[model samples]
Target chain A: MTRAEAFSEREVAMCTVARMVENGRTYWAAGGGTPLYSILLGKKLYAPEAQYVTEDGVIAPEPMLPYEPMMTMLAARASYRALAWGTMNTAGIYSQLGYMDYGVLNTLQVDRHGNINSTFLGEWGAGGRRMHGPGGADTIAACCWRTILITDQSKRKFIEKVDFISSPGYLDGSEGARERAGLPRNTGPWRVVTPWAMYDYQDRRLRLMARVPWVTVDEILAECEYKPLLAPEIQVLEPPTEEEVQLLRTELDVRGQTTDAAGGWIVWDGEKYIRGGGD
Target chain B: MTTVSEPATIEVLASGTAPYHKIDPDGFREWVRDNKQRALVPKLMTEKEAVQKFVADGDYITYECNYLTRGPNSLLHEIMRQQKKNLWIAGKFTYVDVGMLVGAGCAGKVDTGFFLCTPSVRQALDAGKLEVYEYSNVIMTMRLEAGAQGIPFIPVRSFGGTDGFNHSGAKLITDPYTGQPTVIIPALNPDVAIIHVQQADKFGNARIFGTGISDVPAALASRKVIVSAEEIIDTEEIRSNPGLTKIPYWCVDAVVEAPFAGYPGTVPGYYASDPAVVMEVFASVLRGAVEPYLEKWVFGVNSHQEMLEKNVGVAKLLDMRKRETIRGGLRA
Candidate 1:
């Protein structure tokens, strides 16, 4: 089997997201599964100086190995040796003050305008399925210099218009829409990553920047309800190197907690991935 | 994206017109001055007594920190057990505990920023039994801070562009300094705020070792504060480490010495949350078996200790503490 064939969709997504973490930058560490994995992987692989502040108030948290998602916090019996400890106020102030260079957030849907909706699915106030509401995502997206959104791509997710703007992207894709909407100038959705493809907001519109080698641009576009703005040169996303994959599998997520599946646990079944153990 | 001229006098792009839970800052200040007893007496009480005395029916209540970590699950369970009616909640970054409360008909109005769509919560929302006033997690905490500061409102960099702003009691106002638009959220002074901490004294000088998310603000902002501690140490210990005290005795109304108060959650230096137990509860709720789950966990049990002894057992608690000790490297 080919090297690419061995990797799961979740692994690929994480690796792709890890590459976006710029060195010597501060990031709002995500608390969710894949996004959290991506942040840690990025910190470990390349951005060693990329200080992270958690919503739980741990500043510069150096989490221990065999990472248990929630256990990495101050509450975890394992001491993280965090640089400084404060309340959510400290994190909120830091982000609003432009200390955060990058913010990594997960979302359920992303519209053409880059507005994300993690709160509700379907119509609002009409019995929409409520999801995990914007914990710190609102402040992160609004205040961070740039934000990277990680979500699974589907027609329902990559849609024409999000049901609700949990985190404002480019409000209406209009020029200075974000600023007009009272969001800080020169800060908004920077990049969007998925298992299949990568997107960047060029002219405040979702533009296909790169894709995995297996999936065609047309195939990716077919999955999105609204056709994204195509970049002049679509790049083939590099597959996760053997070293990166091994590090992630062994050191970061040994128990396959984050890489198992997006929402549910899964294991590779040689031909196709299948749910394992059961949710 | 192009740079455009700013709107004149800050037009609110998005806002929610939900009635503020308590907006009279002056009244609040007066009440704090007149009603609050600034004494160093033993404020210790049982969870049942604390919840009953402080958490009144139709009162706007809040739990500090995320329900997953450092959340007052035991106190919340007490409220649910008491079956407090029509309570409004400031569910900040909460999911399970809040869902359980709503499921049990303890709370009807929830001003939540981060709550998961469980079957019961969803059913409540769908059936129009629950009223949700959305706000972001940061905004919710900030609102508490505003109340603590005795401010009528607080300004934030974000909120005008999001749906939460529309569903929350947040408004856009002109920043007099920058002559730009700003999102200002109303101050939230909850009737009662319950916090679970790592340690506290008999006088309610609570010290939270890890991530004091919004506990301080919640404690200071609320009319009545209930602090449940994993270990209640001597007042001398608190006096020796005064800086460690996040919530002082003056702010707290009742201090409940409840060990493993954040069961299914974490208490920082004490123990780690059992996610499997939390997941099992979640799964059970999803399966529409909330009644059985509540009966077994909350209603059936008299106290947190009883629940731990009868259902969770000593072995599980020991195992969790061991895991936490290893994870936190408490000994190391």
Candidate 2:
């Protein structure tokens, strides 16, 4: 546990799925990404009575549904949502955020990730979108510190290396994505961490910063569907630190959760794990 | 104060226990008719003929969860399949934290465009024909609460200035003081609100004892509304449990009965949330092409009844649910 102990196969998948909700990262998947994206965007994600005010001062629903014309360089509806994933906030906005449609991409653009989130390409109309990471200029920005856990919807929670990756944010590469919008140099390339491996953009090519704890360098190399990278060091990525564990127990565990009849609450009383009994 | 002997002999005459409360179908039907004329004239009604009467090209429609069944096909799926702008979902993220949303939605529609909250619903969308639109529930709520509370804006630190959504929209903006591009997701107004519950009166008064809060905002946001329930209880019964009601009768427009509803679905007071079926649906999508799924969930299942009635479909779905429970490692 001290120096990069091998992660149990179980831990790998847990990390992948759990890390998917970490702070300050824009995630793109196939269909459902609104909740994760909203979390990354720092919204108050609640359910049932999410509130929103209209431009006219009338209260609206959760999952803001903004006009497409007003979207930023990234295709944003600028709508707030409080539901879990793909929820509508009280503000009358529906993020309409979905995972990427690889099929749509293959049919529309030559470069799959190019303008992957763009609505102008085809039948996507205005609701189409893609996310760009904080640029290279923001590299080393505390914002760059992030993790994206990728476990399948599988029951076993298989934690394989990233199946694919063209770049940190969009397929155009962070810099190219920024430039497409006339954005400045992106230092946020440092914002590269995935379940299978960690990536750092050094000179246009991605460098494997580290592998998930316990996973072999070779395992990472083969699992990824992206352009391969050689390890800068034979080192593995740091596993969940004791400090993080403590933080997970004390600070993060009780953020927005509850208990039910089948299971109890997940409460951290500064010492041990409290399983479901609603006590 | 009667005499002791008199009370002993006749107290039984004063016994105040009412025996049974059978539904007055004829009277209830009359009340429903009146409600239909007044509340449901232009508004959508739950009557099969009425619902079928006003079909629209309007992409979004609301449905109650009670009438909705699981297995990737349900009433919501029917509504979703009707939409042309690609289906975007906004609701509770995980059914139970085992994974994500897989109830009535997963088995209902196929090959249709699906959008999800980036992190929460990402799994369901990925395994299907979906596109990801990353938006924050936190920021959106802050804004909605701000709006609901009548504030111009609410300052927050959730996922601030992250890429793809930095200064993203009317809801998200930059704080001049901090220069941090904050997300300002505006409150949403949905096209329709579909909600489910355990009981409702001839009037729209509904009684539920679980988490039905999310439907409120969604219903308030939408232009149209639908309420599905397990039992059309008496108005007195619904009124008796007014405190337990999530959506009041006035807030509701139409009520339809869908018993044993929330199949492969959850309506809180009605049933427990299940994730095993959800994982299997996702796994099934992973196993095959979305085309067959589209055909089966969309073309194959026409209504919630059909989805739940199909033995093969329900069997496959239930198997997945069972397996997911087993894999969850809940046994300790």
Candidate 3:
């Protein structure tokens, strides 16, 4: 596939997440990679009225640029009064805050039960192959009204069981497990958006709900480590509209930071999408 | 668009066991119980002496700073320079500090919420040279809080849906009061906790601006606390503005006055993260040239003062200072 075709996966993922974002609901975007882009796109296009609670606990209604350097500078420029920690304790926000309505996150591995793991791969502590640990993902998964997980589809990632549970989804595929485990009843994994397909938990098990245009059910099943429960009425995911693509290229990521590979640049010129240009 | 028959039964993955399971909680409880009776006077020391005196081989140490600000970079470099081996480092949202320690082969085990994947650290993990345990940021913070509060454990709502519940050392318990299942993380008491602050007195009363992150809890949870400060003020000044003091002197073991201590990272009110240097280090690490980078920037220089002068240079430092001033002394 060409870079442009490969870029569409990102576009699809971001647009799918953008569509889920509701206006006036406070949403938390945690990771710096794809989820950051999704949240940025959501703010720019669909959820302009949505409030954002930054990792450091600053609440801003205005869209804060997701770039790290820019975010740091913006936080500083806004001052303490504008970007106060407020009543938000780091743990408290994750556990008790009712205002944190939605969270968009990325994880390394997922299972049929929507269990996500970004921690270790082998044994715990001594013999494990360490991956990046759960940052705020555990809290967000356990506490957010709804959580959307985004990842690239691969057999190793789409497994029967995660090596470790970095964040809880549905435990044991049983009803009331989340509530029984002391998670808020209304809070749990809501969607899983991958490069090939989208999944939703039904009957507390991950069910394939949609597939991207070019992907086939056989191909997706072949790529998954376990047999995924297919939805009765699975549908093809609608590709991003021309205007959505245009906004994504021209407004959300004008510099082509997200879409471009290292040393390769793709930008939307006034009339057409172009590659590698000074204009 | 396809439909498939539901599998007759789903197999649940059994939760993995943790290494800490062997550690007797009663022993830790006894240690905490004994420590509460003892009083400590804050000592004044240089960064070198503090690390040398406090940090030991196989010690579980922690430096509580997020990726953004107030990392004890100078102290961590000192630990690297000292070549303290078999050390277990704990952190929440660690970036360069943990990365460098793992890169330098100084860390034996890492207990952290989030760690950046620097090439050397990744290689180490791949090679099974380092042990790692994971927790969510809030879980780790609450664990430290449990230690600070002299409690054996604290119940939390996290890990319910996470694979972390299986692998983490945390226990699943039925809340006695409510009968709801809750995760209980054991108290995490580090051998030493090193933290950077905007200002600290000789008495070790430290003042941290901005978020404060997990520094206070980390300090209180540790057996010994080292305060690395941008400016060492008088005790009178700390007393005058008591609210600014995040970690009290009673919790602090030593105070080390080290300006530009969190270089490459940032100390709020002092400077912003040096992205150019960070990129340079990152590039070197990626290219498998970290040894030369460290040799020149860390070991080649006698001290942080010399390292700053030779590597960061006068111009960049002055520029950073000016930028901090323009930003109203807030880190960007």
TM-score of chain A of each: 0.88, 0.36, 0.80
Tell me the lDDT of model 2 at B3: 40
CAPRI tier of model 2 = incorrect
Q: Encode model 2's per-residue lDDT on A77-174: one tens digit a residue.
A: 12222122222231112111211111100001112121212112222213332222211111111112222322211211111221112122333444
Least well predicted 10-residue stretch by lDDT in candidate 1 chain B: B323-332
Better of 1 and 3 by lDDT: 1
RMSD of each: 4.2, 20.5, 7.7
Error of 1 at A259 (Å): 2.9
What clash count goes with each model? 9, 113, 11
Those runs of model 1 whose alpha carbons end farther than 4 Å from true positions after fitting are: A1-5, A69-74, A77-79, A254-257, A262-279, B1-15, B326-332
* Model 1 agreement with the true structure over B1-332: per-residue lDDT tens digits: 98666544654545677777869988888888987778888988899999888988999988877556777889988898999999998877765767788789887898877776677887887788888888888888899999989989999887778887888898876676677777899999998888888788998888777666688889889998889988889999988868777788888889899888888876666676887876677777666777888998899999988999998888889877777753342321
TM-score of 1: 0.92
Per-residue alpha-carbon lDDT of candidate 3 for residues B1-332, written as tens digits (9 for 90 to 100): 77654444423233325554123356656655665324545567888898888888888888866434667877888888999998887757665566778777898887767776567887777687776666777777777877777677777776655556655687766665555666677788788888988888887888777655578778877887888898888888877868777888877777898888877766656776676776666677656567887898788876778888888888888776666542333421
- TM of each candidate vs. truth: 0.92, 0.43, 0.82
lDDT of 2 by residue, B1-332 (tens): 85432212211111112111122334434444553334423232443432343324432332322221211123454553443333334322222211122322432121111122233233444455443333333333333344334334454333222332322333334444444343333443333455665566666666543222245544444434466666777666655646756566655565666653455543322332344543444454444333344455545765656655772455654543443221111111
Model 1 local distance difference test score: 0.79
- Greater lDDT among 1 and 2 belongs to 1
